[model samples]
Target: MHLRFHALATACACLFIAPTLRAQTTSPTLVTATTNDTSAEQVVVTATRGAKAVEKIPGAVSIISRQDIEAQGLVSEDPSALLALQIPGYAPSRQKLSNFGEGLRGRNALLLLDGIPQTNPLRLGGREGYFADPMIVSRIEVVSGASAAQGLGATGGIINTITRTPTEEGTRHTVELKYGTQFHGDSASWKTGYMLEHKSSYDLIAYLGARNQDIGVDGAGRPLATESLHRAADVFVKLGKDFGPQRLQVMFNRYQADGFDDRVDVPGDRATGVPTTSQRGTLPYDAPRNEVRSASLEWTHNDLAQGTATVQLFKQDFSARYSGGVIATFQDAAIAPVGQLIDQSEIQADKWGLRASWVRPDLWTRGLELTLGADYLDDESQQRLTQTGRVWVPPMTYRSLAPFAQLEYEIGPLTLRGGLRNEHSRLKVDDYSTLAYYGSRAVQGGERSASKLVKNLGAVWRFGNTGWSTFAAYSEGFGSPDVGLILRAVNSNGRSVNNLVDLQPILIDNREVGVTWRGSRASLSASVYRSHSDLGSQLVVSNGIGSVQRVPITVRGFEVTGEWRPLPDWQFNGSYAITRGRTASTAGGSLDLDLGARSQGPDKLVLGALWRPAPGWQAHWTQSVYFSRDANEGKFSGRTSLEEHFKGYTVADVALSWDSPWGKLGAGIENLFDRRYITYYGQANYSGTAEDYYAGRGRTLTLSWRRTF
Candidate 1:
């Protein structure tokens, strides 16, 4: 059902109950930073916008600590690649500049920086995973399910990255240096960074880092096609001051990655099974690049009306430029001929948001708590043809206001929680004309508005003194489709924004049940879940234009995770996940069609081990395996056709580290066997083009050193 302003007002009216509750001895817990300790009581703030332990949450949530990041960074610096091996139900990593086909739980996952959304949902650029360098990150929190906790674009789940903050009492200086190479061709990379942290009456942190990479060679001694010969850098700073029961913090970060113009793509032959490669040559246009600048200011008060209140104001400016190509839609009569024009697409967007929340524990009674919050976002975005300065996708403005209330009640061994969120979003577009290739149709524009009232209910029951618990959860998420693509795909006359069916937002419903057990030296967790959407959004690009196809979709999956510590110096962990999905055929009349690889990925398994051979010496190993899948049913057409067959592949990595008196020295080996195989994306997304097929990376060795003073 649709919710209006009056409903939101009514929801906020419950805040009146805040005045009756008395302030207790225990103040609201705040998870402002992450630590290396693996404590069971470690808190997470992404799930409910408040501090809550992972075991207490009623659904699957993963926390990748600093130690985990450091170990994984030895093999790869890409966050998407790290998540692909660590998180269950997450799709395989493309290992490219864009996270094009990486879906979580067979659906889109939202990326956040300290609770600020980094995804450009209006355009679907697929570049959110590379916003900042992993060196500056303290930890990552993943919530696996369709959740409306942080507002729109969370159909699959949420990945919130927490940045490093000042921890020590005095000023500290640190320097880091790392280098890696495949030892084949010119496949070498290096990174250097410096950081400073200070704390006393006020806290301050600053970091600067830069990374450069040469061409990457696959196991077959061939250079990969994308993200080669690139330079990336970032600058981050944070300042905070505490004033009795309140605190204020300000954070800023700027990141940029630019590709060199010294390489050219060598398309692969799908029929001949030849993978795409690259060689030294001059590019037709400027190389692809990404640039982003973000800042946020937050204020927290612990004694506000006998409750804890948090308010944040944030803004971000982002732009992404893609490779140039001679496509039909880019052929502007006023600029160049249809067959001679080479143009690139660049997306530019600006976002501003305000978030406010209040947590009142022990509201009226013990073990009873309430949380009230609201979020406001304003985003304006557009795409343009860089060469001709022509507006390829007209400017569009999106604004959303969501108000929510969450309640938790605990009784002995049972904990129950429920939340309701009302979202009101509006899109505004001005009248615009299509390109000549699309008949240059004249389309009228108007404002389109949508409202939804989503709900989440969950419960967790712990067995008496035993370390076992069972939980169940049902949640809903709300989000809009790619409005820019829909707006640009209108090739017919007499069309308005409000009348387009493709503009409707998707509402996903998810249900899950799980069990967990924690022993003195071992722990295990498992869950099964099902999620569906009556109307789903899928985009397909043809002739240099994207078209949105709306259909019904259903996805089901199960995940198992376990860890065992048999000895004080030895530990082992593993996880497995299986995901499958179906959608209504876009060919019309067909039903229950299998989703293609672009929409869903195959099963995944990961195993890891940690060993401490002696004092200050340790080693870590990880193995990732993807199972084979054959969805080659029906005809190959867009997202509905499951015409690709994916062959399974396995990769292994190892890291060794030693703590010396001067610093910590580390070494790692990726692809220890150097087994030659095609990547999951290359094999599963067979588009009959040489540029689409790619080989996985070859064996590589990395060395790193870090010191603090």
Candidate 2:
């Protein structure tokens, strides 16, 4: 059911499929070094590990700078709230406190800090970059499709967050303090970020933050959700030493986050008491505790003569504890329930990886470049259940190795880029023991060597002085199945897996292309993309007893995005996405189940814009209108269903900011019109359907202050 060593071996073999490249360009110069402080906003990244203005990258991409963040009052709380309004298809819920945890609020976008991956394969669809710092961000780079060089998990796209780099060119110190309000509780956050550098070759940057919010109840008259408290810190240091014909630099970074969303379910309420959101539920709350930590180090050398070589080592861990579920009579009482009342489940893991890359510039022709890299990863996980205060583990390990290459060339006004990658992945189950009454499991232990192949090609042509550029790109990426999920579920811990059939790796292939036109008066960038996945992990069914299953299906969709800046202060941008998914096979196969459960969703779309008529003042706004009727599994067909098929709704938001000599001041209102909507839905337990709807907050105000010395 899981991808194993086969994937690794196959991917490694693919390294020889491509031809050599010839190109030249030594170091990535500073953005400020090439600009006169004007048009710094047009710098491009990710297309190359370096900088090139957007006009030069051969594919579709977008940028959201630090200026955009501050002017939009993104200084405190739910940073995802803003990204949801920006990236197309990337969805993060606006409501902080909810039953199924944070649902997709903003973009479904894959997020990165420096060069580390923060996506969670186990918990599909929930974006985790919400915990990052926008205050210290140098620039936000968004590449619209799968690029073999960007690593795995980019079926949707890539959002790489580049932190500020300290340089002797400028000296600056900044800090921000902010307080905000929703319909109920008061929220506040403090951030301190610094960049230090001298004319010397050494530079360092750091960011630390602490934020808190007391939650309130939903309109259902149940306890409002309150996420306990959180504290996070990130630090990075770079030491660059110059050597004859080459520059060597060493870099290191560390990050940590911890908190809990404690939801007290009001099981009982005063009969005569007004049915306020808080009075809806009186059951004891279900509180979840979780934490994420990561560390990475890298070394780079540009003049290997043969090419540029870089190597890195990293460790990442994510752990969580769930301790508040309603008491349930054992679904299967054949065996003593260890005392009857059942409560809770958890996911604990550890991952370590190493990466090495080499890039050769122009071995044969001018304007030709080639890059080669490989990654090795080891993942370990433990799944446990609490029975009358007892804990059990159905442990497992998942590992993978991948190597890739890319080539790029330019002739006159035409530029083209192409690349490919192969991943060899392996999975194994260890110390797996116990119970048959509950179900079918991975045969004590087994291995799978599922290899995946990724490829990309892009080209762009500039039409002289007319100010028009033609662009198009084709790329592929795969969405992999969670090996750890398979190990635990089959071991009798999660339901369906107990008496179920078989499991297989879900696979997805994605493709995209686009074009753009810009002139002195206006500019527009538009592109369309589509993705298809077979053996896809689709939610099959879940019985209230905390058991669930997935069937291999086909999920495919198309999307288009556009933005036009008519004036220095006026810009309009928006994106639209639609997905059509269904079971690929049902008649005959190793996997079979009525799974009457439908897995699909209505098409999704959003439109918004940023307007800044002057330097000291800026206004930003956006709206999202859903077409939920297109959704599947009868998610909105229940009691709390706001609308059959989650009737599409529209909401507005606006932000204004002013820069003063003393500092920068800003304010904004989200869901300005108080419209209600669901960003994402579905859960593995309790409600077998996508019943988990994350609420969109009503009108809320945010304020911020920042100063630099």
Candidate 3:
């Protein structure tokens, strides 16, 4: 029985780490590290790309600083709703900007920006988790399950982000403005930003930024029929230099979200969830557009061969457009009838990559360290039909090559990591026709390749006098499938693309265990995980058109996070999670079922409190809960007969900050008791479309101001 449920979840994670290893066997003192330690044992650079030290990394990591993303981007600038409010099996937040099936531990994650690769794995665009502009983020790491030390779409782990640097030396400038509304109407939003930095005098540095936003509505006051139309603009730049130890950098970013709105969708009453609108004016197409551009060039060397070398070269270009739906059916005879509505559709991608790494902390001895790297990608991607321009996802051109190695050692209190990766990929594709419905299908592409190696082991014991830590890991992840939705859904006619064969490539397999304690006031961490794949890809819609289905899944989870500083300016935080998933159809079969809402999401809790009381006032509060799901355990994907479900909710938020003298001021409120709910992928009746039923977004009030000079 799956090895007795993986040996009873590894004996309940070794009885929850055996009383923190017997209270760390007679505590003493030790534990000190600081850069103003923001806990979780600080120092992380995406868990082992270099920098390690999140208790020596071994599963479930999270960082999100920069003052917690400027205090949650002052209530939602949506980085997938701030990583589903601080990542714990993240996934939730379909406030629509398309992160369709926003996954993390259940698969498909690997978005990065400061470390290149903004997902487009051969045309799988779930909008790479909102690329850019969390006000030019300055931190956000997250590394959850599967890991081959990052190569290929981290089968459910890795979110990088990190941008904003210029730590002291000269000119600085900043300005921000925000405004929000909908406490019960006008539905407003506004944002403006600017930033600049310089630090010269020989070791140069520079940074720049820009931001813009406008458009809002919801909470039943309407507008936001399936979201999109929150106009956007973002720009970024960075440059650096420091030759003494060899360093160089360059970066660029640009984002744009255009406008075009006419309104449509107005269907509600899915057994009383009452919400879903838009339909009061023009409508047909033109309303969603997206563009993203990125660039990078980096190099570093801190005495190379002895190790600490880095290099990066990256590029990205993305495009999006959606707003015209309804595909399939044309009744032969000239191009026009039978449910015609193709209005528009678009997707484009271009990625370029190269990453290099080397780290060696006495590689051949003394506490070992090592880490070598190589990665390269070239993606092309495509999809189209901006009204009959045809070709619906048939450009394809992925290419990859990875090489990796990792090793960490530290005797004394144990810490022995291991890693290996190989990965190789190739795709190609050309010949294409489909898109006039099975009758116009032609399909016949070429080249397909794959290779894998993946492996990672882990350990971390750490007790150094007390602070406690424990870990256990085993990782492996790899992905594929979405090769432009299996070559544009080739409907057979002398198929090709290597005879499709379900476009293989998926290999998960995670397993984790964790524990952490940190005291002086209180800190806690906990984890238990399990992931499995065996040919898993599952996205099925059928009549509403969405494909990919290769069963055999299994996911399991548990997480708990905590912090408490009784007083001393007060602090309290919390987190909780419990996830479950299952599936089957072959490949070591017998999973039985239930793995849906686009792969499980729901079972969460979070609570927070922070009060600084004086020296620059600060106050924050939070509460979130979501737990409900059972419409046959949520397997919706074109479900009909109206039995959709998901119904537990509790939300609250508040914020206040001050540190004036012309610098900062903030205010916030979000869904604070406005109660109107329905979101968790809007109860997941998957595409029984009506813009996929929606709601959730009502009480909101925000204000902000910042300045620096």
Candidate 4:
């Protein structure tokens, strides 16, 4: 029945798009731009630690304008709902925020706030996905692919969220109150903020926002899949003063999120006949809270004798807590198969960095633009292990240092971008102990260092009114090892887990090239990128150490996206990606059953439309489909291998809005077809299999209101 239904859905989608596919086969025009046109899009980025438009950088980048956020409709009022869908190569799903604590993918996109790192340095996992709020942002800038300068280990891309600034020379305050419903459910946001010029050469913008969601089950009356509360406020302060021909500036920001979701089992769990659903092992949500604080200083030389130079320094501190409920292995059904406990956690971390840049205005430097920078990381973490009626905590501390440089130059029709970075970090596990029967260990400390070089090179050609560009870039970065890999566990049989920390950090080298056209009516960008990994993380019966053995894998994929505005006020944005990741066995026995990383779902397709039929009134609609590939666990075949056959699913969304006396009013619907689907890379552990994997929310009706005063 699953196979038959999948085939039918595929056929239906093809039929629906058949008309658009066959009509007007004009010269293919692919478009993606981060900078606005004549009314240039408001562009400011911290992607490369720069205050310029992200599009000006020689890399693949995209933007999710604030206009698209509420128009596409948010689930549980989470921003990833609309943000992830706009970018190709990004595989997003509903289970994204629940299990992993955030909408994280194995490819690892690093998240930065304004300029501060949003990743929880103490924990390998980035808790930013679940904590992002729409009220505080002015725009979202993305630097696609490996960004070594952005973070310690980045495999996916860099997401730099820039906040609104103080009033330049206009009104200083605005307030918006919104209310909406999904399937008769309630969701709302109340925001009151001010932006204004301050003191001598200083500017500041401050806002307080509260967002709430009444989400529990699917519109179809299934168990509540996601539920949470979010109340956050942020203030951005910037002071700029002129010193001779140079400019000096200072800025600071703070953001925090606290919320919890109701218990929702993986759909696969129930499907596999394992009784996936249960009121047991659920979290009380009393343990969810996250805080981020950041501050930075910068100086710019506006009139360099020969060119321009910039220098910056910053410090970021982060902390988060998740009352992660009990995660059970199939056979542990006896005395503690279920419980409300946090098996994992990260205490906090402090990071500081510096960057310097120089550019020649007269080209006397031989097309040379130099940038050099360095950073330091101090992080601490601890994990809780539940044994025969007891909870034990193991502590760890980490430190890191890194420095990098890059030079870019252009001559005639060729522009080249290249850079290299060396990163190193040390992890120390402390005051650690386990059950004597399993493995008695007194306080023991362990340290590991990861170092790598990253570089980039790209070129573009110019012609009369049109320009075509193509470039290949390469970079190498390392991901910190999972903390649990070394921690010992006390099994149900009363045996202590053997030490497993022999594992190493996962490393990746990515290569990419693409073609683009910059024209008046349209802008298109298409790229093909691949990332190869060696000696990466593989799940073995995970202990506090390395898994049973080792293995290597490759993630090869393609993404195409474009934006077309053929007529005034009419726009279209669409993207599609076919991504496949595989791992071949190396040395080691089965770890974590090799059941797949739950993050590597199958193929994904997305389409978005923005139509302003009339001024102040807009209609937007988007649909995304996620595909899954089936496979047996390592124990089933005694090894890991790729199999053919696409798993199934499709989700649809629509929203319409109009200016109102109170504010902007709108309505929307999700999963209009009421179809069930699973994540491409089942994110819910074993719960992600066909039987227990998660599902899309059923038909939902939403109404919203927004006003700027």
Candidate 5:
């Protein structure tokens, strides 16, 4: 059964207003500029590894400025929620500690920090989105389709976060304080941070921040579980030096979060419409937690081989501790019986990489340019049981060497772009034994090597003096399956690590076309895309054993984004996206079955308004509506809960800010209508289990104050 599009009725008719924060005293605009002149451009570096105007990128690109970050932070500080609200093709946020089912364009999106990879593809614990705090970030660049610009793990797209830098000369101190609560049932939370910046012969910035979150209540005034309750902290520092035509910079950041030890879960009944709740109790072990540390050193030269060159050395260390589970793999005869053992899993990953690039303008003619780059990465990862001291996922080492080249040529109002990347990778594993539940199979391990070549081509044409542009592009992305999961659950009698059928790399083919129109006060863009994969990864559970399945898949979608400023003091922006996906029912069958919720999400519509009514006063309002879907009914043979049937809901948020002589004060209200509803993830991916049937947060109030001196 091929999936088909369904019509959605408009859910809201009332108009609301709010405001955003800008660095200067002027009011914020949805686009780059607010005046009648429409030529102002926003520059992005993630699309092609070099700076280029958004209109010239020849692809779908989105830039979330600092102003937008600060404004949304007032409502919620979670980066995953921010991205989900702003990006059109991104899946809805789960509002939890993990991003396991948050897909971009029906696939995993690679995350980067200042051009350094943040995800360990082999393990993919889904905590990569929490590496950087929004307060320390200056901007984020998003490319919305499959791309090979920066090498591997971009099967869907790319998201690169750029950190803040000293914009003013001299010494400055900044402080921020925020508080949020539901005003019921121990639901109070607070965050505070301090930053210092000094500039002279050398530029330096340092920041420290901490947050404490308590229990939460749903819209119906029911107490929810404490799965997301935790204590979080961040430490960041950057130092830079300038030497005429050369510059060097070093940055380091450490982020840590730990769950509370006192709370225990009270399972809910999905079939009876009950939500999971939490209560204070003594536990056998600590709760789930994540600790991440990253550092990078970059050097840039203006004149290297008659072109600009940049080199970066980066490192990341990550560890995640999961809650205890009673499973077959956790059994240890020496420690306890199969059903009596309660053990936890902890993933450890350490990565280091070196990336270098050079851009040469006017290669052969005035309008021709070329970019060359190479990247090297070495990653070591493993998973082990904390209590039993048993290795669940044996130690594995992976290394990759990728070299790429990109080209751009301009003629009159038409621009052409192309790129190619070749990646050579090797995986080394040691002989290990599977868990006793899997027949205690002894697996032989050795080295496996493979290579992949990906390419992209695009063209952008601009109409003469009309502020209109059209683009078409074809791109390919490369990614590796979760190797750690497969090696640990192998039940085969005589299988070698090098010959496992599940270890093959995935290659995605993407094709897109779009048009954009920009005016002094309004801008609109629309795009349609299709992506295909001969061998894609999916998680399947059988007989209480979870494993990875490779199948053929296809995803198609269309998106529209628009922004308009009917008046100087008021701005309105909106976006809509519809995505559909299907996969082959059998290993090599035709694509006739609908994809699961983990790969496909419901249609989303988001609208926002901003107003600056007074000199020092700003107001903002935003609303999101998810449409109901029932395309996959009666498809899973009663194995999963609907899996594709989703009930729709509406959410609204409002914020107000004032600038006083002493500091800036702000307040926001989330879930303004207090609509009682289950989250999209919980409804669409239900497993008929009480532990996963969760509800969205209730009406919450947030207050904040900030100052700089």
Candidate 6:
């Protein structure tokens, strides 16, 4: 059946492009810088390991420009929310600082900062998405689905946050201030930031920035204790020099957030799934503290070995303390007779790596390009109890070396791309004792190593002069379970980690077909994909503790997006996504079971319009819709076992901006109708009954001003 579907989809795509094949022999004109042209050329680096036009890439890719970022006025500190809003197949935001279950294409995605990995795959804390502030970001690039271009943790795809760089040869300064508050309540917050850039005539540039923000409350006028408090300050600096044939750049960033809230959650009614809440009181745990520090140096040499060669070295240190929660209950011999809840777990990670790549276009053949790269990474991570200083996840170190190559060949109207990556990694862990659940469990750690070769193949057919293109791709992705978690919780008496052969790496196969049409006033794209894994890892939460469960599963989805410009000053855009998944079960002689909310989310739709009625004045509005979903969890076998029947909902947002001599003034309202709604995760798979389930914030009004000199 899967093969039949793939063939049909491919045939349909080819049929759509057949009309324009005759124009393939003619030379195509490259789009130049023109103000009147609505379509602007975009270059992407992550998709192909080198700078390439977005339209030429044979994959699901989206670019969120700087202008788009400013226009959205995203309130959530996690940029994942921004991606969810713009890109299809991205799960909806959980509204928390964490990205626990935020999967792309139903799998883990790699997070990158200037081509450096930010994820701690060995520990798998799920906080890699929020490493930096969006203010310093120049643009965001997203590539959906599996590919060999990136090494580990890219079972889903890659998201690279490109930082701003100096453009002109002059000194420039900018400052921004923003204030926000609930419409019907006094949950107010403010943020301030400043940036300085100096570009010298001698091909040298320096950039620096600093920002600070305060904590805020929720829509219900309740302090957001569990939600990531924003008492944070961040600073970044960059220095660059260009010496005609070679260029060098160095960057450093530091961010810290710490705050204490007097609040706790009490369990509410379980039948209705109502959450618990608290007015005021400090919990018996340490305050939340999150710190991230990073540094990188990059060098680029042109015409090295008849190609462009680039090398980068980077290091990152990250530590985060989560709020107190009822993770586990264990009894102490001298402290208590009965088991008590142990709250607070902190994660610390250090990562450093070196990456080098060379790109040579038209190497020995016309319309053929070759790119080769090698990467080396060393990561150390550990998780501990902040209260008693007891290890939860034992310290683990990972070393990886990967070599990859990609080739692109263009012939007539069709472009073919293929790549291969060899991944070799070694993980080492020392012996450690586990926390006392019923009793202290001893774990014997050891070393494990794995090597895999993944491949990707794709083809894009462009209908010359028609502004239409279609692509088909097949790729493979690889992922490993959180070894530390598995090794630390060994309950089997006298079992060593090395003896546990059940924990094996998972590989996923992805197939996709897509079509895109771009005209003078309209653009549309549609894609269908299927991804399957014989051995897939699913996060299972029981009694507030999460663990991985391996299962055979298949996921299929489709996405459609369109944009139209009815008038020169007015534009409308929309997108829709539908995803369905199933897993194999051995309940009664191997049955295909429906994946619940814990593994899959509901369908999503977004519609918006932007209008610039007058010069320097802009207005925008957006509506987001989540369709209902009901999937049964066979374990429970009742209404409660259904994992919260998600109901459909629609939310609206509006914003306006105006240019002024002093600065640019902006005002916006989120949740325009103040319609209270439950978040998708909250409704489907919220682990705790006491904490406020994922409830959408109430109406919020934001005012901001910015100036540049």
* Candidate 2 lDDT tens digits, 1-709: 0112332342233223111100001001111110113242366646565445666666556566666555545423455655555544444343442222221111124566666666655443232544355655766677655455565556556777776666544455667776666645433334445544433444455555554444433333133333333445555555555565455555455544444443332322222322212222332433455555666676767678668777777777765555444334222344455454445655566777887777787859988888778878787766454443332345556677888888878788788888888877766654453333335332345554568777777777878766566776777665555444444444444333222233344444555454454444333343444454444444332343322334444333444444445556665655554444344323233322211212333344565565666767666666665554422343321243211233455666777777878787878776676554433432112142322333444566677777866
Deviating ranges (above 4 Å) for candidate 1: 1-37, 227-229, 541-545, 587-591, 638-642, 686-688
Q: For every model shown, what is its TM-score relative to the native structure?
A: 0.93, 0.77, 0.34, 0.79, 0.94, 0.91
How far in Å is the alpha carbon of 175 misplaced in model 2? 1.9
Q: Give residue 238's error in model 6 in angstroms.
A: 1.3
Could you give the candidate ranking by lDDT, starting with the highest?
A: 1, 5, 3, 6, 4, 2
Q: How does candidate 4 fare on TM-score?
A: 0.79
Please estimate how well model 2 matches the true structure, expressed as its whole-model Cα lDDT. 0.50
RMSD to native, candidate 1: 8.5
| Residues 1-709, model 6: lDDT tens digits | 3434644563455345432211100011111110125242568788888888766777787777777678775343447667777766777777666777677867778888888777777777766666666677877777888767888778788888888888888888888888877743326667788888788943332333343333334445443435555466778887888888788999888877664465555444536745443345677777677788888999998888888999999999988888775554434545445446556888999999999999998899989999999989999999988777778888988888999999999889888999998999888878887777635677778888889999999888998879788888888887777776676566657766677664677787888888776677666666788888787776555655555666787888877666666678877777666777777543112325666665566777777777887998888887888888766545543223435467767888888989988889999887788765667777766353646465666677888888889
lDDT of 4 by residue, 160-187 (tens): 7766555455445555554544443332
Give the per-residue lDDT of model 5 (tens digit) for 487-535.
9989979999978988888889999887666666666666678999999
Worst lDDT 10-window in candidate 4:
20-29
How far does residue 280 in candidate 5 sit from its true spot (Å)? 1.1
lDDT of 4: 0.53
For model 6, the superposed segments whose C-alpha errors exceed 4 Å read 1-40, 74-78, 183-186, 201-225, 325-327, 334-342, 543-545, 585-591, 633-642, 686-688
Alpha carbon lDDT of each predicted model? 0.80, 0.50, 0.72, 0.53, 0.80, 0.71
Candidate 3: which stretches are off by over 4 Å? 1-57, 61-82, 88-94, 100-153, 156-279, 282-322, 325-391, 394-431, 434-443, 470-476, 485-517, 524-562, 567-571, 574-607, 610-620, 623-709
Candidate 3, number of clashes: 0
lDDT for each residue of candidate 3 in 265-290, tens digit (9 for 90 to 100): 67776666666765556656677777
Number of clashing residue pairs, candidate 6: 0
Candidates, ranked, TM-score: 5, 1, 6, 4, 2, 3
lDDT of 3 at 402: 90
